[model samples]
Target: MASNWLLLRCRCGQSFGARQGTKPSCSRCGESSQITTTAVFTDPNTLTEAVANANLPSEISQQIENKLNEKKRKKLKSRDIANAGTIQRILKQSTDERGVLTLQSLRVCLDIEGVTEPSAEQIIGMAELQGVVHRAGEDEWKWLA
Candidate 1:
């Protein structure tokens, strides 16, 4: 199948994406110059990744890429947890009597559940993204959902 998105580089050196067959003004310079199409991506995530990588300096790209991957994994893992009706249970199991979830509690809960991919920190980050929890103190989160 043909790609749905095109990655383009503007004269001002900004990298951006546009739908195929459409000309988009530079998001940075807004000059609407005839920018060269750099690559094609099949999905918005891949397109976003391309644009982000293009905008980053080569030396630090790997580090930033690692962080981006962690974020992506956390989002995916959180969605899985929510879909499985386990977010509430996990939150309950991982939190204390005061409804505060600690990293250690989450680790033990996940260990019991055999969910070892995301790790405690990633699960906590994901929970924060779902708006179900927020940091209440160092190494602990309070229920928001």
Candidate 2:
């Protein structure tokens, strides 16, 4: 049977494929890159057991899983903030008689349930990147449209 290879991207933007259980170096930067696996297999007939039993301890494995889950959750939140009407609503609420919106005021106006200030800032950064808003002063932002 043919061995399955996993694709990896290096920090230098180089992409390559490597067989399982191997750490490949980036051809362009000569930096060692870690392999990321997407699936877990408990079949006794497969090499999964050996891989799981390898030098990786249960504690390290749990930490890695937690970090991956948090990363995925943050990515989903960013996508939702970008696609949702968040930018429009913020702009509408912030553009009033004052004609200026401070970052703190914008955060309060957003009223996103259970959202942290850092997460709200990230969403605002994404909006700025998309040209939906721009910084007018140190703590103020001006709506583009």
lDDT of the structure predicted as candidate 2: 0.60
Residue 13 deviation, candidate 1, in Å?
A: 67
Model 1 misplaced stretches (Cα beyond 4 Å): 1-84
Worst 10 residues of 2 by lDDT: 39-48
- Taking all chains together, each candidate's TM-score versus the true structure is 0.41, 0.35
**lDDT by residue for model 1 over 1-145, one digit each (tens)?**
5658989998888889998877788887886766889998788889999998898874376688899988877766744343335655776899888988999998888777756556788778888988889999899799986
lDDT of 2 by residue, 1-35 (tens): 55565455556644445465667776457778443
Clashing residue pairs found in predicted model 2: none
RMSD of each: 13.1, 12.4
Model 1 TM: 0.41
Question: How much lDDT does each candidate structure score?
Answer: 0.80, 0.60
Measured by C-alpha RMSD in angstroms, how accurate is candidate 2? 12.4
